[model samples]
Target chain A: MAEMYSTPHEILYYEADVTGKLSLPMIFNLVVLSSTKQSVDLGVGPKFTHENGVGWIILQEDMKINRRPVDGEQVILQTMAKEFNPFFAKRLYRILDQAGNVLVDVDAFYTMVDMEKRKVARIPQAMVDAYQADQVKRIPRLAEPTKFEEGMEADQVQEYAVRFSDIDSNQHVNNSKYPDWMQDVLGADFITSHEPTAVNIKYEQEVRLGEYVRSEVKIVGNTTLHQIWANGTLSAEAEITWTEL
Target chain B: MAEMYSTPHEILYYEADVTGKLSLPMIFNLVVLSSTKQSVDLGVGPKFTHENGVGWIILQEDMKINRRPVDGEQVILQTMAKEFNPFFAKRLYRILDQAGNVLVDVDAFYTMVDMEKRKVARIPQAMVDAYQADQVKRIPRLAEPTKFEEGMEADQVQEYAVRFSDIDSNQHVNNSKYPDWMQDVLGADFITSHEPTAVNIKYEQEVRLGEYVRSEVKIVGNTTLHQIWANGTLSAEAEITWTEL
Candidate 1:
C-alpha cells in the first residue's frame, strides 16, 4: 500500500466564481499542487527528474465533483499512488471538508518521458520504488475523454495567445490551464446557470509560450466536448458534463 | 492602530516561473488575497458591501520585491489598513519568509464606489468606523504611475479577449489579470533574464466579460511603461522597473 499525503487549503475569494463556490480551474490547481507536494516528499519529483534527465508527463485526467467548497472554507487535499508500470502510473486524489465529507475525487494517468529525446521513456526502477508504485489496487476507472474527429466543425472557436502567466516552471503551459481554456468556451451565461459535475481530459501535445492556440467546443445535451489546437496541431481534448445549479 | 492579519502560504509549483522563483503575478495575487482576508475580518468586505450597495475599488497600487520565494517555501502574508479618509483608503502588505526576512512590500489605494450608480461614492461613516479608520497614521507614499501621451505609438501591442476565467464575482476582469497581461508583453527573453524590482499601476476603468482589450508596452532602459485600452479608451496604465538577475 502506498502512503497517503494530505494538505489543508482555505478557499480564497479569488478562487471562487460569482456563485461563491470554488471554480473548476482553481479546484484543478489545488489538486495538482497537492500531488506535486506529495511527489516531492516521496523523492520522485523535479529533483529526481532533473538528475535523471527524465520527467513525468500527465497523459489523461478525470475528476468528479460531489460538492464545491465555498470561499473561506478550509478543505483537506489528499493524494496517493494507486498503480505503476514501466510505461505508466495512476494516481488518486480527494478533497474533503472538515466533517470528512468528500467534495471531489480525481483520477490521473501519467507516463515517463525523455526530456532531451521528446519521447516516451521507461520509468526508472528507483523512481517507481520511491513512490511504492508496484502495489496493485482496485481503483475505479474514470470516463474516457472523447477525441474530436479530424475536420469536425466546432460550434464555438476561440483563439488564445499563450501568455507568460500560462507557463510554469517546466517552461510549458501548466496542465490546469487547459481546463480554464475549455471552460471559457462555455461563456458566462452557460457557466452561471450550470456547474461542472465531471471533467475528463487527455493531453496530446505541449503548448509553449508566445504560441497561439485555438479552442473549439461542441455541445450536445448536458455534455460538452472540447479540443485545443496549437497552430494546426491538436494539443488537447476534453469532455465535461454540467448540472444546473 | 488597526489589527494586522497574517496568513501562511506554501508557494505552489504553479505559482513559480521557469526559475522556480515566484512569478510577479502570483506575488500580486498573494498580496491581494491577504488584503481581502483582512478586510473581511474587519467587517468591511464584500458581504458588508453587498448589504450596503457600496464597495471598494482599487485606485492605484505599487509593489517592491526584495526577494522571491521559490516552490515549497512557506511564507507569511500580512496586511493592515494604514490610513483612511472620507474618499480614500490606504493599505499596506508584506510578505515574509519563515525566518522573518521580508520578501516583498506593497502599498495600495482604494476608494468606495456605488455599485448601482457605477461611480465613486463617499465612504460611509459607519463603514469607516467598522474598520477603525478614524485614527490617523503616517504611511509612505508609492511612486505615481506615469501617464502615456495620447498620440504615442506603442512598441508592441497585443489584443486579448476577456474570458470567463478572467472575470471575478463582480462580473468584471480582476485587477490582478491586468498585470499579467502587461507582463506578457515583455516576452520570454526579457522575463528570463530580468526580475521585477518595482511596479506602479493605476486603474481607470473596469473591463467586463466578452470584451477585447489591447495591451501596449514601451521600454526605456530598466523601466517599462504599459497601457491597456478597451476600444480606444484608456483602461489602465503601469510602470515596472526590472533588474538583471
Candidate 2:
C-alpha cells in the first residue's frame, strides 16, 4: 500500500475570510497542492508526466468540511492513493488541526490523459506499481453531480473572462478556480451569511485561455447549483450546500 | 537590530503559471505571508490587532522581479521590519532560491489604522518597541506611482464585481487581488507574451463588498498604467513595466 503523505500548512491571512475561517476555494487549492506534493513524492509528478507525455486530469471531487481552520492555525493535510485501475485513479484526503482533530475529508477521482491527443489513456501498470497503490475491486463512489437540465432557466448568470492568472501549466483553467466562479455567482451577501458545508464538482470540459465563461447559479433552499458554460458548451457543474452562519 | 525572519516555501503547482514560473501576484502574496509571519513572531499579529482595535494597512509597495522560480522548487522568503516612525512603518523582503540566488526584492510601506474609524492612527511606541524595528531615520522611499491623468481615456476599461473570494478578514478586498484585476484587463495574450519586471502600486481607497470596481488600463511602450475606480472615485493606481519573454 502507498504510504500516506502529510504536509503541514499554516493558515495565512489571505486564505481566510472575514470570519477568520479558511475559505472553500482556498481549501480546494490546498487539496490540490497536497495532491501534487504526493505525486512528486511518488515519482509521478510533473517531471514524470512531461517525460511520458501523459498527465493526470481530475474528473470529480467531493469534500465534506467539518470545521474550517482559522488564520495562523497550523494544520496537516494527508493524502493517499486508494486505487488505480486501467483508466482511473482514486485518492483520499484528510485534513487535521494541530491537535490531530479531523477538519475535512475529501475524495477525488482522476484519469490519465494524453497531453497531445486529449484522449483518455490507459494507466500504465508500471506507474501504478511504482505507487504501490491499494488494489481495491470496488472503489467507494461519491455522489454524482447532476447536470443542469436542458432549457432550465438560471436565477443568476455571471460572466468572467478567463485571465492569464487562471490558466495553469496545462494551458487550461485550474480546477480550483471553478469554485471561485460559483462563489462569485452567489454574490457577496449570500456568501457572508452562509458557509459551505459540502461541495461536489465534476469537470466535463477544459476552459482554455481567453475564453469568456458564464456561470449560472440556481438556489434551492441552502443548496446552490452551478453550471459553467464556455463557447456554448458546458465545461463544469457543481453543487454546494451551505449552513447559515 | 531584529534578526530577519526567513520562511522556507516549496513552489506549488498552483503558484506557478504555464511556464512553471511563479506568477507575480503569487510572489506578492508570499511576501505578505512572510511579513505576517514575522509580525506574529514579534507578537504583533492579528490577535494583537484585534485586541488593540488597530491594524496595519499597506499604503504602497514596490517590487523588482529578478528571476521567477518554478514549481517544486524550494525557496526562502526573508523579511525585516526596517523602520517605524509615528505614523508609518517600512519593511523589506527578499526571496531566494535554494541555491541562495535572489529571485526578488521588495519594499513596502504601511500605516496603522483604526479598524472602526477607518482612519490613519499613530504607531504606538510600545508596538514599535516590541518589534525591535530598526531606527533608521531616513527610510528609503519607493518610486511614487503616477496617477492617471484626470479625464484621460483608457484603452481598455473592464468592470469586476467584488466577490466573496475577493474580500479577506478585513472586509475589504485583499491587496494582492488588485494585480489580478490589472492583469485581467490586459488579457491572456499580453501576459503570456510579456513578463513583468517591476510593479509599483499605491492604494488610495478601500473597495467594499458588492462594489463593481472598474479597472482602466493604458499601455505606453513597455509600461502599463492602471487605475481602479469605485463609485466614480479613484481607489488605486499602479505602474507595471514589462519585458518581452
Every candidate's CA RMSD: 2.2, 2.1
Write down the C-alpha DockQ for each prediction. 0.76, 0.71
Q: Give stretches of model 2 more than 4 Å off.
A: A134-141, A146-148, B134-141
User: Which lDDT tens digits does candidate 1 get at residues A1-245?
Assistant: 77888988898887887788998888888987787788788787889888898888988888899999999999999998889876788998899999999999999988888998989998888876877765444434556787667777798888998888888877799888898899898888888998899999988899999899999999888889999999899999999989986
Per-residue lDDT for B77-151 in model 1, tens only?
Answer: 998777877678888889999999989999898888899998888777776676665445444455678766667
Residue pairs clashing in model 2 are none
Lowest summed lDDT over 10 consecutive residues: which window, candidate 1 chain A? A133-142
Give me the candidate number with maximum TM-score. Answer: 1
Q: Model 1's lDDT to the true fold?
A: 0.85
Q: Please state the CAPRI-style docking class of candidate 2.
A: medium
Error of 2 at B74 (Å): 1.7
Report the lDDT tens digits of candidate 2 across residue range B1-245.
76688999878777888788998778878998898887778788878887899988998989888888888889999998889888888988999998888899989999899999989887777778887887666666678976678688898888887777788888898888788888789877788899888889998898988788999999998899999999998888999989987
Candidate 2 residues A135-192, lDDT tens each? 6666666788765675889989988877777899998998978998998888877887
Misplaced by over 4 Å in model 1 are A135-143, B134-142
